[model samples]
Structures are given as structure tokens and as C-alpha cells.
Target: PQLGGPIWADPIHDIEFVQKVLSAVSTNPSRFGTSKRIEGMLSMMTEELPDVPLYYALDHLCSTVHCNTPAMLQFRSALLHAGYRVSMSHASRNGLKTDAPPGVIWDLLRCWEKANPVKRERLSETSPAFRILSTEPTLQACFDVREDANPQSRKRHLVRFQENPQANWGPKARAKDSGGISSELEDKRKLCQNKRKNQVTDASQLKNFPCKRFRKGTCTHGDKCCYSHESASDEADKME
Candidate 1:
């Protein structure tokens, strides 16, 4: 429903696809630590999805307890990946400690300060949450464990984030729309291929939009290329 992409194609819905993996994580989250197998499984979603995942839908994906070292670091990394600017400011860092480990309010303030240091510093910072809300307002996961760092206790939290309609395509829609979505995805791939293919011949254009195949002159788009097919001299004259 948001910029994360359509349904299963986004990280906002990852908990749905990987519920089993998440469930396997126990209080000794170290039990299900980042192993080669887990990493490989995680890689599948990103490798298949268009771009790298922007943000993980960790909202409610944390335990009511406390976050352990691994969870804290991972949560911070998730915010960083989601384009949140983090700072090591005394105020922000100190503020972060008082709250659960997963909230990004302080990070949002850091981002705001970077963009408007003078005004931000000048203003009385009452509600950091309010400050965070004023900026780009999209709901993001801020899941954190209560007092326990045990991953097993967070199973329900993970499931909570999965209850979103965006995560569930509904059985009927899944059955009906699967083929259509696949077709659309294939069409997009071909379109990108053609765009890259046509970007050959013109070095400047190619640099800006390199073709995967045409770089080696194997572009099947040929004269049908959407990009300029100008030679070096021709390109120079055109630039002039």
C-alpha cells in the first residue's frame, strides 16, 4: 500500500514470506544467528525483488522486553537502510537509551538537524516523537522487545506486523492475480532490457544508461534502439 512496492514484492511484507524463519529465532536469538543458510534465504527476496529492500516492516516485530545486542544493531541497520540519518549526538544518543531500542525518533531528529541545524537547535525540543512525525510521515516498524532480549518472546510481535492487508493478498487474489503480476514483471524486465540495449552506440548516453548487452555491440535493439546511435565524431558534432 506504500512505496515499499506491490504486495509480496516489498520488505514491508517480508514477515509473511519468512514467518517460519523468524519463528525459529529463540530467546537465545544467537541460536538462529545470521548463518550462511539464513543469509542465503534472506538473499532470495532481495535477489528476486527489483531493488534492494528499502526498509523491513519491523513494526511490532519486536518483543515487549528489551533488545539484545544483535537485535539492536540489526534494528539500527534497518533504519539506516530505510534512509534515516543517524547521528551520535549526545542528546540523541542519550534520548535513544531512555526509549526502547527500536524507535527512530532520535534518528529522525538527527536528520532534521542536519538539514536545519540552526532552526532545530534554536527550537525547544519537547516531543521528539512529534518532531519525527512532522517530517516525511510514513509509518515504519519501530518494534522492540519489552525487557527480554529473547527472540522467541518476539514471535507475536513479528506476527503483528504481518496482519496488514498489504501483506495479505487474500487467497482469491493470490490465485487470480499471480499470473497477471508475473506477466507484468516479465514485461518490465524486457522493457528495461530494451532500454539498456538501445543505450548503445552513443558513449555518453551509454555511460549514463549503459546497456547490458549492447556495450559489447550485441544489442539486438539495433536501429530500433531508443537511445542515440551516434558514432564518436557524430556525437562530437552534435555536442558542438
Candidate 2:
């Protein structure tokens, strides 16, 4: 069943919680919900995903300099539109070894430098083409330029490395920062983990057991117990 509730602010963590709940239901069917009709429930739930993450940002790792720089430039422009500043660098292929040496940015830069010597000079000028670019969302702008102010229509591929403004620690920092998640998926993961931990082991599996939570129909922790059946019943009634 689609159990609707208040939307969690942190969907990533909520998805984990839901997963844990489902896992608990699946493994401990007798203790939690009955297993007789669970398969259909799971199938339906999987088929009709109401919410999901669309565009997740991740650090694009360039392992070598052999690859082209134009692709990276295009990526930078796209990210810029989507609100991300990026460091620009080009790679050279003439002197590049079949295998680029590990642990260096210059290796990539040198390759591009060889390919586009003119671009390198432009980058080095007082007004460098490669820059730390950012467009502020200022409500009251100090200056506004006409659409045809420059009188020169520029091509998109012109700007290469426009470093990300928020990334202070460079590639390492950016890589560490980016993350992705959907709330529903995360909730479900948590439900699964809890189920696994509390699962009845083979040694005790064959034994005819009483309700796991209430030791002789009485929970030791009373209201604080996570597995307290009385509390669960109250919760179910409240939900209904």
C-alpha cells in the first residue's frame, strides 16, 4: 500500500528508512505484516514510483589527458547554465606518453597547451579567457548592457575552464562534496537493514516462538521499545 506521510526534508535519509521498514516486513513477516500477499505489494510499489531524483551533480574525473578538451569545455558551459563555475585547462597530445603519469594536472594542461598554443597565450593575458566565472543573482544591478552591446556574437565553445566558484579546495573538495539520493529509495534501504539485523537465525528459526517483542505479552521497555506490539497496534490504528 502507498503509505503517505509528511514529506521528509532529507529525502536521502528517508529513503533509507523506508527500505529498512520493507526489509523488516519481508523477513519477519509473521512478526510484522503477513507474507501471504507481500509479493504483489512489492511488485506494485516498484512499478509505480511517484518521486525520483532527476539531475544529480557529480565530479567528472578526468583520469588522463589523452581525451579531448572540447567535451570538457561543453560540459563547463552546460554546468555554468545550471549554476556551476569550473576550472579550465587544455591537454596536449604531441609529447603525451601513451600513458599519462599519475598524480598531476600539468600533464593534462601540457597536452592541451601543445594543441592550442594561441589559446594558451589568451589564457595568460591580463584578461584571461580561462577564468573564475560567476553570474550573481542580484536584484538591483549596478549596470545593465544592451543585448548587442559587444556587437560580436560569440560561439559557445570559446570558454574552456571556468572554475566552480563554491569549490575552494579544487577537484578534491568538489569530488568529496557531491552526493545523490531519492527519499523513497533511502527510506526503503533503512527498512531493509533493520530487518536483516533482527532476522531470526537458523538456530532459532525452527523453534515455535511467541511474539518477538513482548516477553510473555509484556514488553520490558514499555513505550520505549521499538518492537512493542501494543505500540505498533496503536500506530496502525492511528494511521487508519
Candidate 3:
């Protein structure tokens, strides 16, 4: 006995329920199951004949459209009005031809624009598929063909970036989770200071260094590394 809300709603389970009713002959039969709720409900046993009731069943209604365009919602509404159970699924642009029939595509766009005037303009304007369709006639009839003919095709957009991508922290800006540049600089500064503070000093180390070049900030080897080494050498030489 499937004692549950789902059994009352789903149409496909009606036959299964009937089969279970016919098979269970004993008052207290062991029913193996996964759901704890189902197991607990099935544990109910009665010596007297129990009455079970059948309610409504569940089923999904759906429909398909050609092109899988942005005007899908509008098109779905039109089909629904014309007594068709329809729903839309996203498709890929690689399969769709660049030039689709203007009439059908335009009709879909018109209906979409009417229903959602604010969003219709430039909705698919910059899209690759739309751009190709707008300019080329070779693939004009592609959009007119029903999705069943070629179900995998869709419209998509491609964008290009010329500069380092700007991270637009909008009006409500929060610090990035990544430690900031200041924190990194501070860490580096601390590391440098610690390295200098814990530096080992010996007479052999002092003798093997160039002290003069670093004092004027012009060490021929490199500016940054040379400056620090030369500064240390100069201090050591002064001490000597």
C-alpha cells in the first residue's frame, strides 16, 4: 500500500498501486523500502479489512518551438492561446544557421516586444546568431524550421575585451576577500625587516662585499638588490 501524497497526485503510479494491492495478501507483511516516511506509513497493520481511496493523478504538459529565440515566452503564450501545451528549453548557437527566415523570426520578436516592450529592444541584437542572420541571406530559413528538425541549434553572443578587465565594484563596494595590495606590501616590508634584523654578521662576510657603490644608490649589478647589499657592506666597513 503506497500511503503517500505523491501516490494521490501522480498518474503513472496508479497501475503500480493497483499491482501492490493485488499482491499483498497478509495483514502484517514486511515491506522493504528506502524512505523512512514510506517505511513508517507501511508499518500500519489492521486485522479488519482496510479501505484505501484513489484521488487525482499527476502529468506534465509541454510544447516545442523553432529557433529557440529570445522571444520564446511570447511564442509560448501564443501557442498556449491556440490550445497547445508548450514549454521552452535553451539551445546552443553552433547548430543554428546565421540567416533565419525574417517573417517567422520577426513575428516571434513582435509578439515578444508587445508582451515585454521594455526588454524587446536590443534583446538579441548583439548576438552572433542574430548578427549573422541580420546581414546574411544564406541561412535565412534556418530559424523557420521547427526545433524537431534540428533540436541542438541555438543563438548566442560573443564579446571581446581589449584592456585589463575592470573589476567594477558597484555602488555598494566591499573589500575583496583576497588580501589587499597594502596588506601584501606590509607583509613584504615585514619580511625584509625581519631578514635584515636576523642577518648573520662575521668578518669573512664583511670582507666579501662591495661597500662603496651602494652608498650613492648606484650599484652596477641592479638598483634594488644592490642598494640593500651595498648599504649593509658600507655599515660593516664603517664599523671596521
Candidate 4:
């Protein structure tokens, strides 16, 4: 099916960007880092660009399949509308060499996927295509959405989430900062500490002497003790 609507712009800009990228890589320029100029060019493609990076996998590293597959682009674009990070992989072509290079000939496609969520949402809403390229919610977060917006259960059922939901992927800083203690409990602890620091008690002035050692069951002096084991109850009563 012809998935895209009529093209409005001429192919001139496309040709210009492609030639510029090709020229940049060809000159062996000093600005290129790690002899990986192609990666730099790939990174720059997202600069004010309408494209989403889709990395389809070859089970065999050195396969004959062309890198720029048009069908993959359309399929991925459709999936992008549904809020997904889509990549196609050949299952049967696993006969390649084991000592392959790490990472991409370009930056990892998923990293590029998260680059522009606004453009992605716009692409998603454009054609209303149902051809699913992928279903995985590559980005969503309880942390990303407002707490009232969607519950954690509903988060998984939907693709789109709050803007920049990556913060949900990490440990919650607010919970850690508060040490998971509630404000009431923390206040009670502070109150107890303040009582210990600010209130001085004299055993001689007390009507009922409470023995600290009795609480731990370490008191050897029973009836002869000036502090009474029963005084704990009296102290509790006084406080109440």
C-alpha cells in the first residue's frame, strides 16, 4: 500500500544532506573523532531532520541485505505512530563470525530513538497506519507521568507516557532522600530526641523512681532498690 501522503518538498534537500554527509566522511577531516566519521554523520541526521533511526538486525553480520531498506522505513514509521522502538532482525542468518565489532557502524539506534519525542509523536499521528513494526514501549514511566495521569498498571497497557519519562528508569531520588520514613514518624523521633536533650530529670525529685535497668531485665536489686520496677507503669500514666 502507498502509506505516505503526497510529498510536498522537492528531493533537493535530501540530495544535499546526503552529499554533504558523504563529503564530510570522504575528506578524513580533523573534527571526526575515533576515525568514526559515519557515526558523527548519523548523529547529525537528527539535527532538524524528520527521520527516525531504525536499525534492522542481520543475523549474519556480512549479509547481502541493503542497509537502507525502504519497507523497513515505512514499517517503522507506522510503529513510531503507535509509540514503539522498532527493529527487524533475521532469525535464520546466525552463521556469521563470532569476533564481530561491538556497538554500531552508527550510534546505537535506540539512543537515537529517544532523541526527539515531539517529532516522533507528530509522525505517529500523521497517517494513522495500522501496520505494526513493533509493539514494545521503548519509553514510559510512572516517574515520567504526573502521579494523577496514569497508574502504574495503565502505564504498561499504553505506549505514550509523560514527556521525558527516563527518570522513572532510575532509583527514586525523593524516596532515598527521605530514607522512606514518613513525616509523622520522623517527627515522633525528633520529639523523643528533643525530650532527651531538653528535659533533665532528677531521680531524687521524682514521686516514682523508674529503673532503666529493669526495662532490660538486668536489674539484680529487687525490693532493696530505691527505683521501683513498678515505676515504669507510673511513669507511663504520668505521661498520658
Quote model 3's TM-score: 0.18
The weakest ten consecutive residues by lDDT in model 4 span 91-100
Q: What tens digits encode model 3's per-residue C-alpha lDDT throughout 1-240?
A: 135554432222244453465245222335533233232222221110122223111011001111323433334344344333332221211112212233433444434333334422443766543443343222112123244332111121111112234454223333346844332334445546756764656655554455466567656666334224545656778789
lDDT of 2 by residue, 113-177 (tens): 34433333334334322321112222211112223211111232222223355734332312112
Predicted model with the maximum lDDT: 1
Q: Report lDDT per candidate.
A: 0.38, 0.34, 0.34, 0.36
Please say which candidate is ahead in lDDT: 1 or 4.
1
lDDT per residue, candidate 4, 67-166, as tens digits? 2222323333433433443332112111111111223211222222333222334344333221121223343311122222222222333221123445
**If both were scored by TM-score, which would come out higher, candidate 2 or candidate 3?**
3
Candidate 1 ranges with C-alpha deviation above 4 Å: 1-147, 150-158, 163-184, 200-240
Q: Candidate 3 — number of clashing residue pairs?
A: 9
Shift of residue 237 alpha carbon in model 4, Å: 3.5
Model 4 spans with C-alpha error above 4 angstroms: 1-15, 27-31, 34-40, 43-240
Against the correct fold, how does model 2 do in TM-score? 0.15
Please name the candidate that would achieve the greatest TM-score relative to the true structure: 1
Candidate 4 TM-score versus the reference: 0.18
How many clashing pairs does model 2 include? 36
Model 2 Cα displacement at 9 (Å)? 13
